[model samples]
Target chain A: MSSLGMADKVAIALVLLALAGQLFFQSARRRAPYSKLRKVNAYQSADLLISAVAEKGRRLVLGIGNNLTDQGASLSGVAGLPLLKAISRRSLFNDQKLQTVSGDGVLACLSQMVTHGAYQNAVAVELFQPGEAVLAGTTRFASLAGLLPEVNHRANGGVILSGQFEGETLLALDLAARKNILVAGSTASLGGQAAFLAGVCNLALGEDYYAPAASLETDPAAAASLRAQDLLRIIIAIALLVGAGLTIAGVL
Target chain B: MKKGLPIAVAILSGLFVLAGLIFQPYLGPYLGLVLNWAVIVGSMALLVAIASLIIYHARSILTARKGFIFSIVILASFGLSLVGGLWLGVDNPAYLKWVGAIQRPLEVSLLGLVALIMTSAAVQVFRNRGWSPLTVSFGLSAIFFLLIALGLLQTLEVPQIATVIGYIRQLPLVGARGLLIGVAIGAVMMAIRVLLGSERPYSD
Candidate 1:
């Protein structure tokens, strides 16, 4: 304990609790529990986009904004990776295609890898198009600007804006809305959540709420991760309530 | 070994960084070096990414794809900017101006678009609401914010109205700050998962 601060110990304890929770849920299969994650229409819209692409042979556009690195809040992009895996697998299964644009080159590269793996896992590696993931400049507007015109071309099925979006979110959301394309956005950026609430048809709001992949239960690993996240969230919420109550009682 | 080595490396490096950040011991030097290495590795990844990008666009141009013109433009811009940056150096005023010429207009256009979208969204706010209590609350709050933004509320000659707007604006601020904490929690959760090898984007 001397090797780390008190706060670090708290963080370690919490992570262990999360790991424990994940294990508990996975082990107790007969007594299944449900996560209290609210209904996010973005998951439905994502599912719809896959079905639409299959049914109509239309293209799906994926916008993973400027957040790509493994550092800091960029994990929001990583958090949304399961959706990409799911969509890529579905597209491969249905013999449809999807295009991805990213503000970060690293993200585009990783996304390509993810898509390739998804196709390979689905046993349709030949249909995997390596060129679908494009790095549309690092600048916020530059990325959106380059992708806006591309959407006009490939947008027939739908578009899902995921990852980290900030001030330039409205442009992408608004442009997608203008095209009358079925659009949904998922991100941890408060700006993204607000923009989606205002313009996009569906949304996954807070980073805490990116539990879409948990519902699918296709990947046990992802389910376990979601269980951990939900457990942590409940703990935090309870702590907040307790703190608030204690403060009211002049004991905080 | 392939998977095990990567996950093992990730967890050790992650722990080192975390411990250094918290403890500030001799391990801090190693943590700093690891971070520097991370940045160096990230920079190298950019080169690979660009090579892949160039290949993709080149194929489109070569195959005469429908958007091949855009591909040409992309390649040309990339080539020119790279050459100019090398020739003039990134810090040169001329190089900066050259890049800004490409950046400024796009930024302006996007901001203008956002403003238009915000206006349109506000105008059509109740179109789908069907007069539910929730819709009414949302619509009223939006209008209240809009009135404050437009200086319409200040025109009422009531000082107390300004106070109300001030308090109202802070509501979103407080909510945003709360969301920031939520974002931090989510980030920590994700980082821990990555470190534990429970969430491996790199692993197939």
Candidate 2:
């Protein structure tokens, strides 16, 4: 083993903290029968839209943005897969179609795989349609242009944007608005978050984008993850406060 | 074993990567190898996705689906681009310029439209959310930042006022850092989940 650098030490500490948090929450969940999750408007609205679309027998679209393979965004890209799995599990049995559009090739395949897994879990493996997950475009704008048709024509119920997206998401938001399709979105990108805040009121901003499984109650581990995030946030806030105090005191 | 195997592979690979990160001096070359493998696999996935996309568009055309015309246009463009890339070689300067010429303008125009749409969305935000605490703060902060960005605040040369402006200018960065920290924590939690085999997106 190599000697740990400061960054490595910090990384290890964070990982251990998360693991401890997860185990603590998991044990706590076993002791208590209830797990209360704070309500998020994005997931709540998405639930309504999914049911409404299912009732109307219209297609529901999930847009996994184009940055899945991007160096800085690979984790954000994979983060949406769990959300996709939850969504596909919920909506796959409906007679209405559940389609996914991705800007990146690897993301499209992963989405297809997740949907397939959902179908398998539901014992509807034969009904799984790989083509439902489409690589709309490889680049950002091309993906936006490719996605608009899906949003405008097929998303009769609504579209859920989850993944890393840029400001191009606004154009999709604009079309979804005009079409009267309910749009709920979450993006890791700050620019995309700003657009969502301005355009689509039902959005998961900042770290909330990563809490889909917890918000939807799809996985217990997801709930644990949420708790861990909360713990970390508190610790960070305290650290920042202390740092500021120390700086003011000329002791930092 | 089908489900178990993917989970095992995922957990092992994830742990290996984490270990490599923690032991970079000793394991850097192995990490590089694994990353190269990932790159290759990703490229192959891309190829498969492109093929599937072509099939999807071709099927849309054959079935005479609504807006199938767009699919035809997409296929034609793809075909032309493929032919050009193959015949002229992707490294050729002319080919690179030709692709860039089409790509750059489309991206720029879309960015312009997004700016216009974003401007409109500022109004949409107020209209839809209707002055809730969050929206009110968002609106005020947005206006505050926009005004500051326009250098309207710079005309105030008073020492106290300049100091306040300096403090105010740091607000965006502070907010951004807060968001980044939260996002980073979330990302870390996700990686941990994958490593622990608690949430398996690959198999389940």
Candidate 3:
């Protein structure tokens, strides 16, 4: 095969252009609206989550999953942070107690996000204690083990497991199930398998994790990125169909 | 100052790591070597955690606190596991056999305990929550049923049930695939947020 074919070169150029456009729009602070499909469940589960945390007067265990600094890009963590902020804001607005536990060094980041959310809702910073919001552990099983007891003992009102998770997610879900807590879970690309195994997540947000933040916060950059992603998915789907057709026709 | 410094270090280190990722072809090996030092530091932190666990347990034992027996068991397990690994070697068949024997019962018992807890909790929720519980219960039960019906519960030896369950499990993959595709797109957006420093995760 040639080092670089015409089609390959064009494809690479398109990808680069898309990435560059994304970077430019993100930097410029452009907001994009939901591309028709995602606006479906805008605030369906949000009210329940908010009420569970704010009115119920029970602790909210926000498991940010195993995506920490050492754990790479943490696509799930990014997606979950906005949702955490939104939930935290609602909790604070309702004068409800909100506690977060993270399995990675992202504790500081998560703590700040929660603190900021609290601040936005005119709540005290002291309420968002670094200790309360953070539990440092590495590895999935260890994190889950460390977290399960806390969730159970606290009688957490709502358990949000949004981020990158793995096989250990089953253990967390099992723990939540045992505790009779409201559990909402969303995973990024890597978390699909774990998400599949979780039999009882109340609100299974799937990839629409970014939707809560994007739709709720109206974060323009996130919205724009989501739009770009929609375009990309459509393009990829079309490409797949074409490829399949060609294959079926016995074309190279 | 204490919190600030760590945050600062995290930000600097994170930026370096991101830069390394972007220019990995040229900087990958050297960056990897630097990250190996990070691994060593992390391992040392793990040691601190283990030490903290020992200290807490020892304190509990001396104070005759609740779950002292559990502490003793933990300490004994830790000591025995360490000694056995070092003296008998991790690969030693005798050590493996002893560990496995202990492990099997512990695992099975823990799993069984979880199952019991889940059952009790489910009953309590249904009993107490009333109408609202129905939606959640139904969703959870459906998923649980599907997961079990699928090959996940195949070890129980009901082939007919497993076949039906497998097809049911396969049904959701299409929706899951769509969701995954959407998530991938969102992830790219998030990555851009990080790379452009717009998200500012390290910022307080």
Candidate 4:
């Protein structure tokens, strides 16, 4: 739309460099004897659920929350796509395939693509079923009424509600609890966080939403992104503390 | 090109939006056009989603699934909404009223469930986790939550109570702000990955 300004250019350059640095780490780690690792239960649980659900003869359900949009929760959903692909790929031979329920139209589209890609990897392009990803509803809560029944009945007992979710998360999580299904979800909103804390499921709070994606990749570069996020978080916390202190001292 | 084309479009769209936000002079004029195109594409996706949903439920009904009636209801709702939105025009008061009639109740009911879910979860947490930091916080918040929600603690009646509530309110705000910052960083990382073609969701 417009030319990038100096600050805009700088920010873009910094982000690109940071991402590139992560890639460099990914490549370099291949040669290194060892690399630091972090445990994210969300990804581990996804893997666990694959086996658990398969053994139980139940399908693994992926609830890509309806929060996905061009502006809102798009990145969060996009970040989780790799894992969706991973899970879909991993669950190829299972009796029940991965069932994706999404509330947003755009996300439903991407999820279909992800499912198809996974199939293309696992078997053949012809076997890619577009129905793998179902559109539940347009809004978060509206989607819940349509989604919960599907998960409760078809999924057998596994659900992952990772995406840009708002208040409606509580219902899905509650339904999961009633069905005694394993549920783990991440929330980006304050209300959603509260609901999540109170809902019956494994929690992915705040930015931990990206943990599944990077952890699932296990690429040193992808993992480096987590470290970069941690660095940024620390800086922000420090800035907040400084701001609070300065405000207390009546300084602008 | 399966992966390359989508990633390229994403990078271009992302940069255009970023430039529009930061520069606002040169790129701002085309921002609306780009956004409009996004809306059109998104609408197309929604249309496809509708078709998929219908086909899905139709299959269920054909199979005589236990809850096949629910499929009929879902289809009817879709038809009604389509007719309302398309025939009446989205801006028409009839459409607006119809939306509010349906959405308001759903929103309220869903929000109402939040309270019950929170209470049940808090109780379960205490029983299972046995009073961890989270449970303890929930317990403490429960006391003030009732006092504030029930309007027992009048802000004007007691200046100290008002100050306390105000301070407590700021806690969640601060946490939310921090979380937003975290989410932003994560988003940036994802954008960078897409731009670099390191992470392509479109291709195997």
Candidate 5:
């Protein structure tokens, strides 16, 4: 700690602060549930689409974006897991297909495990298939190409994309829109967010990308994490405002 | 114990890594070892993923599914790439060029298609979002940025115009920074959740 630079120290302080917030919220929720997560249009749309697809005997697709490895934007990739499990659990007994696709090998494997676990929890192990989760392509464009066919054929109900992706994913969103299938997406990348804003999807932007699990009320810890995120967001916003004011006042 | 073991391992390792990052001078070697182990495990997982992919395509071909022909094509391409990579060594220039010749154009063409889709999507944004304040602001900002990006404003070269353009560019930076802070906070909270065993995204 003595050898660490100023920036490193600040980063450490921030992490510790957030960690403290998380622990506090986690214990608080265990005592009494936190139920005040703000509404998210994307999750609502997903629920409606799932019901529609289940009724129509069609399928739904979840694109667990490509940036899942250590070398890429992995946090946002891992962030999609809770949503994957939630979707799999929700769609389990309905006889409607739920397929997941990813460009990264590790992410695809994790998705397969989570999906299979969902089946296990539902007591429907016989219905689970290995092909339900797929490694579409190792590269971004190839993965998009691999996913388009599934979107074309199976996504009769809707497509929900929740992961770290780039601008190319808008092409998939566009394709889904053309087919009149319900589309919803979220990404932590700026370009991807812009693309989603332009496309016809119920979109979750910025911190909302991390709120799906909490919004669904599936896991108490997720709700706690969202609270921690909000606490830190408020802290950072106040700091930014103060800094701007100081600069405007000619105080360094 | 099956679940508890993974959670414990995750928590301890996460703590150790965090400590190592903070106190790097003392625990650098241990940090390297842990990261190397992670790399090894990740590589093995990749192998398993590839094997599963091959098996999936094989089953499709065996069952003569609707797109069985594409399965055959995928498998053939996989085979060719694997054999070529093994025989010629992946770093060989000829092998790299051989792969790149096919990969580069396909990726570029896909990107071109994405640009076209983006243009169409931009047009549809108005229709889909209607005349709401958010959509109106988005439309106006986008058109403003597009004109700036095309150098139409730059061509005028007036001092006041350039100053206003500079301020406009800084406006996006402010919004971008706000978004970045939110994303960073969310990511840190998620990591903390994993460390505390409140979330088990890696649980099988």
Candidate 6:
């Protein structure tokens, strides 16, 4: 019954291992529909956006969703790098231009991944121009405003907003929709409010932002991490149920 | 060494931060000073971004691009704002008045313009994808609407409805918390990967 007992530590470690294993197997199989219940909303959105870009021959616009360096967690920014890589590869394969914009330095690191991804996909480095890959904006609204015109004029086939979006995402999505561009979005924070007003986009909530790379690349490490997350969720749920039952029985 | 330097710096800085957190009385002052340096670096980065914007836009204008006029306007506004803020002081009455006069109206108008755009976009979404796509969209949408409704009703003094809605909203917080805890564990593993040089963000 001790709070910091060996049993609890061992149990938690086992749960994490189990989760990692699940993710590894699922990613390796590549048969897991982006989610257990349904397709992961973000992956579905990315797929839809990619298809639209491929079909329309229009450029894809990706917003890293963090306008302030201080506002987002470092982990969210890191997670976004892989997603940017995957999206950039898809853009290159389709011979579509991928325009990325960042609001902070941490978010800007994603440009490296986009560049590498484009190169790995055998897209000419010249064609994958630096200016075309990453643009930085000063303020949140200013970045949204700057990207709005680009979305409107570029005839963007698809728009992907993932990372740490705020009120600006709704504005960008609204502009994209007006241009008849397909848009998909996800935010690591609760700012998914913007996704609601924007309407009918593939949006990921909280940790679901991590689902795309595993789904797309089937990378073993990423798969294992995702599996760990799933198992952790189950363990937490069981713990919650037990706590509730004990409380109800007045045993605590 | 090039790749290792960043990871090494990250570890040292991370340790400093942790020490500050755990041993605040002894290390707090130094951490505070370090954080100030972080802010200075952040400011430098912002300056770089602004400079890039100026260069990009100037080139576009010089080349007589289609959006040259707008670029000019942006540049002018940016320059004037910076000069005014610096010379007159942002807290000065004149500068405050200028901001008060311009900012709210500009923001309101921008919001209004985007509202119209949102309406058109929503109509287009319906026209292109129909109700099925609408129904299957992100769960965040439902949460957003619920929160907005709850906020509005609470302001209107509807306590009973607001209370119920608030509790329902809190239901997702539990799941969100669980997800966060899971993510924290994943982050630790990923950090270990980076520290062990298994995952390199800088390398191709």
Judging by TM-score against the true structure, name the best candidate: 5
DockQ for model 2 equals 0.72
lDDT of 2 by residue, A1-252 (tens): 446677777677877888898788877885442267665678778778777888888889899888876645458787678778888888887877788999998998888888888888888899987788999899888899988888887536888998888877889898888788888988888888887887764888767788888887777788877887888889878978998999999997
Tens digit per residue, CA lDDT, model 3, B1-204 = 844665556656766876676567777897998788777765664465455556666776998976588669778888998899999999999999998898767666656665564554455544433556554754576668767756467877897977777686685676668777666566656665555554544333
Candidate 6 docks at the CAPRI level of: incorrect
After aligning candidate 4 to the native by TM-score, how far in Å is the CA of A31 from where it should be? 3.9
lDDT minimum window of 10 residues, candidate 2 chain B: B195-204
Where does model 3 sit among the CAPRI classes? incorrect
On lDDT, the stronger of 1 and 5 is: 5
Q: Which 10 consecutive residues of model 5 chain A have the lowest summed lDDT?
A: A31-40
Candidates sorted on lDDT, descending: 5, 2, 4, 1, 6, 3
**RMSD from true fold, candidate 2:** 1.9
Tens-place lDDT per residue, model 5, A1-252, is 667788787787889899888888888778555566666788778778777888888898998888777455357787788889888888887766798988888888999999888888888889889899999988888788888988898536788898887899888888888898888888898988998888898988888888788877788888888888888888877877898899999995
Clashing pairs in 6: A19-A227, A19-A228, A20-A228, A23-A227, A65-A164
- The model with the greater DockQ, 1 or 4, is 4
Q: What is the lDDT of residue B106 in candidate 6?
A: 68
Q: What's the lDDT for residue A15 in model 1?
A: 67
Flag clash pairs in model 5: none
Each candidate's interface RMSD (Å, one decimal) is 2.4, 1.4, 5.8, 2.5, 1.1, 4.9
User: Which lDDT tens digits does candidate 6 get at residues A1-252?
Assistant: 234367656655764565455546545656543444324667776877687777878788777765445754466655556667776666665666677777665455446445655675574665655456445565566666777777776656777776666654677776665677777776656545444445656666655676566666435556555665666667666877998999999997
lDDT score of residue A162 within candidate 1: 77
Q: Which runs of model 3 end up more than 4 angstroms from their true locations?
A: A1-37, A40-44, A67-74, A89-96, A105-128, A167-180, A189-198, A202-206, A210-212, B1-25, B37-181
Cα deviation at A241, candidate 6, in Å, is: 2.0
**TM-score of chain B in each prediction:** 0.87, 0.94, 0.64, 0.81, 0.96, 0.68
Q: Report the number of backbone clashes for model 5.
A: 0
Fnat, model 1, is 0.47
User: Worst ten-residue run, lDDT, model 3 chain A?
Assistant: A190-199
Fnat of each candidate: 0.47, 0.70, 0.22, 0.58, 0.71, 0.16
User: What tens digits encode model 3's per-residue C-alpha lDDT throughout A42-151?
Assistant: 24455476675666677777766666556564556656666666666566644445656666654434454555556645746655433445543555555666666656
